[model samples]
Target chain A: SAVISQKPSRDICQRGTSLTIQCQVDSQVTMMFWYRQQPGQSLTLIATANQGSEATYESGFVIDKFPISRPNLTFSTLTVSNMSPEDSSIYLCSVTGGSEAFFGQGTRLTVV
Target chain B: AQSVSQHNHHVILSEAASLELGCNYSYGGTVNLFWYVQYPGQHLQLLLKYFSGDPLVKGIKGFEAEFIKSKFSFNLRKPSVQWSDTAEYFCAVKPGGSYIPTFGRGTSLIVHP
Candidate 1:
C-alpha cells in the first residue's frame, strides 16, 4: 500500500474564492486520480491527473471548474475554481498500486 | 456506461450478529471488483478485492466476500459483528485491466454493542 497525504485537511472558504488541494504519495506511481464525495452521496470521479499533460475530466465535470496539475510522479494538485456552496465536498486523491487503490486523508471543503 | 449498486442504504446489527451487504455491477465485460470501508472520520481503506482466480476473497477484520460472476454480484459477509465495525462500506468496479473504478452509493453499517 502507498502512504498518501493531502494538505488542508479541512478548510472554509467564501463563495467566488478558489482553493487548491495538494496530494503527495510516498512513492512514484503511474496514475493519480481525484474524486469528490458530496454529503450523503457516493464518491464521483473528478479527473485523472496525468503527468505533463491535461487531466482527463469525467462526465459532469470540466477542467474549467476543476483544474489539475501533475508536475511529477508523486505529487498532484486539484484547484476548485470559483467555488460555490454546491462545491462543498470532500476531495480525495487516490493511486492504484498492485491490484488495490489507496486513498489519502481527504480534504473537507466548505464554501460559504 | 459501467456502474455499481449497493442494495442496502443503512443496516443495524447487534454484536455477535451476522452481517451481509449486497453489491452488484452493471458491466457485461470482464471486470475487477473491490470493497472499501470508511470508519467514522477516517479515510477509506481496502477491505477486499477480486480480480480473478478464486471467487471467494478474504480481507482484514474477519471480512469476506464472494464474487458471483453469473449474477454480477459481490456480497460482503461477516460471521459475527462488532460494535467497532460501524462504518460506511462502498462497492467499486472497474473493467478488466482498467485503472478507473466506479463506486456505489455506499452502505452505512451501525453495529451496536
Candidate 2:
C-alpha cells in the first residue's frame, strides 16, 4: 500500500493566475498520474509523470497549461497555469504499482 | 478505446435497504475490476477488486461484487446499508496488459436515516 500527501486541500484563485499543487508519496514509485474531475463527471487523466523523462500528457491537455514536474520518485508537482473558470475542478494525484492504485486527498481549485 | 459504464448516477435508499451498483466495461479480453468509495471530504478508497479467482469477491464494509465474464459486468451489492454508507462510488476497469485504469462517471448513493 502507498500513501500520498497532497498540498493545498482547497484554493480559490483568480483568473490568469497559476496554482501549483504538490504530491508527496510515502514510498518511491515509477509512475505518477494527475487527474481532473469536473462537477458531475468522472476523472480525466491529464498526464503521466516519470522521474527522469518529461511528462506524457494526454490529448486535449497541453504542457503549457498543465505543466508537470517530477523531481524524484517520491514527489511531483502539477501547475495549473492561466486559470479560467472552466479550470475550476478537483485535481488528484495517483500512483499505481500493482493491481491497486493509491490516490491523494486531492486539491480543489476554484477559479474566480 | 476501452471505457467503463456505471448505470446509476444517483441513488436514494432507506436504512437497511439492499444496494446494487452496475458496472460494465467495453473490453473483451482479460481485465481487472475494482470498486472505490469516496466519502465527503475524503479520498478514494478501494472497496474491493477482482483479479482472478472466485467470481464472487467480498470487500470491506460487507460490500461484495460479482464478476460475470459473459456479460462483462462487475456489479457491487450489499444486503443491508447504513446511513454512513452514503457516498460516491466509482468503478474502474484496467484492460489486460495495461497499467492505467479507466474510471466510470460514478454513482452518488444517499442513504436516508
Candidate 3:
C-alpha cells in the first residue's frame, strides 16, 4: 500500500473564495484521481489527473469549476474555484498500485 | 455504465449478533469485487477483495464475502458482531480489466454494546 497525504486537512473558507488541495504520494503512480463526498452521501469522481496533460473530468463536473494539475507522477492538486455553500464536501485523492487502490487522508472543505 | 448497489442503508445489531450486508452490481461481464470499511473519523480501508478463483473469500476481523456471479452479488457477512465493528461499509466493483472502481452508496452498521 502507498502512503498518501493531503494538505489542509480541514479548512473553512468564505464563499466566492477558492482553495487548492494538494495530494502527495509516497511513490510514483500513473493515474491519480479526485473524488468528492458530500455530507451523508457516496463519493463522486471529480476528475483523473494526468501528469503533463489536462485532466479528464467525469459527467456532471467541469474543469473550469474544478481545475486540476499534476506536475509529476507523485503529486497532484485540485482547485475548487469560486466556491459556494454547495461546494462544501470532503475531497479525496486516490492512486492505484497493483490490484488495489489507496486514498489520501482527504481534505474537508467547508464554504461558509 | 457500471454501477454498484447496496441494499441496506443502516443496520443495527447487538453484540454477538450475526451480520450481513447485500451488494449487487449491474455488470454482466467479468468484474472484480471488493469490500471496504471506514471507521469514524478515519479513511477507508480495504476489508477484502475477489479477483478470481475462490468464490468464498475471507478477510480480516472475521469478515467474509461470497461472490455469486449469476446473481451479480457479493455480500459481506460476519458471524458475530462487536461494538468496534460499528462503521460504514462500502462495496465496490471494477470491470474485467479496468482499474477504476465504482463504489456503492455504503451501509452504516451500528453494533450496540
What's the candidate order when arranged by decreasing lDDT? Answer: 2, 1, 3
Looking at candidate 1 chain A, the ten consecutive residues that score lowest on lDDT are A96-105
In terms of lDDT, the best-performing candidate is 2
True contacts kept of 2: 0.71
Q: Tell me each candidate's TM-score.
A: 0.97, 0.99, 0.97
lDDT of 2 by residue, A1-112 (tens): 9999999999999999999999999999999999999988888999999999999999999999999999999999999999999999999999996779899999999999
Q: Could you tell me the lDDT of residue B107 within candidate 2?
A: 97
Q: Is 1 or 2 the stronger prediction by DockQ?
A: 2
In model 3, how large is the Cα lDDT of residue A28? Answer: 89
User: How are the candidates ranked when ordered by DockQ, highest leading?
Assistant: 2, 1, 3
- The whole-model lDDT of each prediction reads 0.94, 0.96, 0.93
User: lDDT score of model 1?
Assistant: 0.94
For every model in order, the fraction of real contacts preserved is 0.68, 0.71, 0.48
Runs off by more than 4 Å, candidate 2: none
Residue B73 lDDT, candidate 3, scale 0-100 = 97
State each candidate's chain A TM-score: 0.98, 0.99, 0.97
